[model samples]
Target: MTQINRRDFIKLTGASAALVAVPSVLKAEIGSAYEARVVVVGGGFAGATLAKYLCLWGDANIQVTMIDKNPNHVSCILSNLILNDRLNMNDITLPYTSLQDNYGVIVRQGLVTDVTGDDVKIVHLDDGDTITCDYVVLAPGIEFIDVPGLKEGAANNFDVVPHAWIAGPQTELLRDQLHSMQQGDTFVMTVPQSPYRCPPGPYERACVVADYIKRVNDGDGHVIVLDPHPEVTIEKETFEQAFNGIYKDIVNYVPNATLQSIEINPGEKIAKTTAGDYAGKVLNVIPTHKSGKIVEDLGLLPVGARFAPVDSASYESTIRPGIFIIGDANDSGQPKSGHMANSQAKVGADAIIRMIASKSSSVDFVHDPARLEKIRTNSACYSPITYDEASFLTAVFAYETTNNSMKLVQDSFASSNSPHWNKDNFEDMFIWSESLFSNSFT
Candidate 1:
């Protein structure tokens, strides 16, 4: 069997030695020019960040192009707050014009059909257009694979089970269902296993929904979270406090509860779970996911649909060079969140710049052999534990460095009681959103 190593592959490309000596900024400029065009597919968190950074900091010589199926993107990060009426959808939705106006990025509103190394051949509205480049960044996010019996109209049931994790229509559907529920009604939320986007999302959704039920229905409606993990990975202390003190009577959190299968009858508005059968006015089933289908189709992913394995530091796919994967699509052990995606985007953008510069110059840039041996990759997630209070939690993990990998680092949890907490968090949320929006779209 032929063996391929990340470091060996980088060196064999003949650009590795030049990459080590080239500065990131200069490399980016060279790659952004016509000579070193860069095509970034998927205008979500990862793609947008990569495009913007490459344009702003990359060598001016490179021409950066960003492509996506949609012109406007609604963020998955803040969509959960919409369920509790904490935020509106419009606040999170952003248009692509900012990328064109603010940054010199060429925006292509189309679907990516295929990705070859250094060449992204796409089909736009049934018309084909191929863009050749020095590097291709694949950040198409994730797609929920249709399970055997978990798809719309799969079992002759018109009833819909919304996985609001994807944002947009599915999110609106879940919100509508929640609002339509009567008092004393029940809602079941299922959390998928590890390696999914937003490790804290399912728990955060439960908290927000429970808060809504307490306010509107006076603790009449019930929320049961069926978690596959042994314990919640985020805000555990704060969540426990919220559940015990605020929604103690309303929410039932059942850990180690996995979904065996589902029995849905649309006519009767009924569903059955492994834990027990319940007739709820609404049901939210967030199933397992894999890299977006396009990744697999382009032969960028490995055998299993779990994730795209890549060089740990650079995020360049092991299967192909000149192709990078970030966000929820990559096999990095980090929690799949917009924050981490942005971080990884920076690393990927820098790596691509180095690779391009090496190719242009005669210098032999040695790739870092120890780049993948880093100690920690951490992400912080903030969840509203109460109507006027929220908790900031951070999870840290040592990837490929230690056997006992996962570690939880608890940040300060601020309640509404603290005047400073509310003020700071409110300002922080807005600034974070604006920063991301400005960096990506603007």
Candidate 2:
């Protein structure tokens, strides 16, 4: 693998200084004895990247504490490979050791229960501990909205069926279930509404599952995709070609097929859904999302919104100052994918560091001409059409000062042509992912 320097990393993420403006005066150059504390909740791509960049860019006066309930984060970036047996859990799991040992970031293992503050922020963890900070970043990723008739912890429940969206034991369980498929068995999966984790994820899963079934069962197997949206949400032409041409015989694409409920019996190896229930041998249901419990519990979400609304340039909560929300939990218009989250983290980290250096608690600094000049974030996704061929999409979101929201730059949107999947794109996927994984974790 070629070693990617910081500049290459920024370019690959599409968040270079030219694309996304940095404050004229950064924190590292403005050294001060005034210590500022930043407590980041959750250890996924967003939070971990924020913690890492904050430490790397901020001066010694900036102290960061990262808290995640789990010891390590299993990445959802390359998780689709789990279904095809192309990769295992270890390939995607990232630990926080480097953040603590190398960057002096304080890593804590605990669940945060509540957050309260007036000028400063106070985080209450479930373990009877409290964290006080000048700035609080909530990168808690996302939590799934429960569907009717499906219980998370019930015996032989969804876990047995496995969404595997978060990438962990559920991923392994779903992988094992796929392996047990018979020659003519069926694999059924549901796609949540748009604005879910990754737009191309469900279609990717469908393609890989169909590919696996075709390879193992001699093209006798079947795969079904039940999407609630009216059509493919992203990379429309690319996935349409894959479904209608490449794997047309084995793959069934159903749009506007919303999932209302589910019934499963592991013993019979059967599952049912409201969208014309079938006795598929395996089932995967990706659920709708809400901001993490920490955000909801703190009343950070706007009234009737599933995610916390934030300033696009700074990523600071529009409703709550001094509290920033990055990643999937924020209501930023960006896609809730790992790569996009990492991009948002950089923007958030820079804004936070600049805020502290100026000793300003309010996010009004985001409006300064220098700060607002070229705020943008890039989102790129690679969808595997088969085990060896893939297609990709890229979009750049620039902050519009008028409405104070991020909008897709018309000229910055591009995707691989339909029916153009190839080995080179597939190989580039690994290289891109390796760069992302290394940049975020280590």
Residue 129 accuracy (lDDT) in model 1 = 75
What digit string (tens of lDDT, one per residue) describes model 2 on residues 178-200?
99989888888889876888888
| Per-model CA lDDT versus the true structure | 0.66, 0.80
Listed per candidate, the RMSD to the true structure in angstroms reads 8.7, 3.8
- Candidate 1 residue-wise lDDT, 218-307, digit = tens: 879999887877777655665666667678998788777766556556522333445665556677878777897678877877676578
Which candidate has the top score in TM-score? 2
lDDT of 2 at 378: 72
Candidate 1's displacement at residue 123, Å, is: 7.5
**Residue 205 lDDT in model 1?**
86
Misplaced by over 4 Å in model 2 are 1-33, 152-156, 266-275
lDDT of 1 at 435: 55
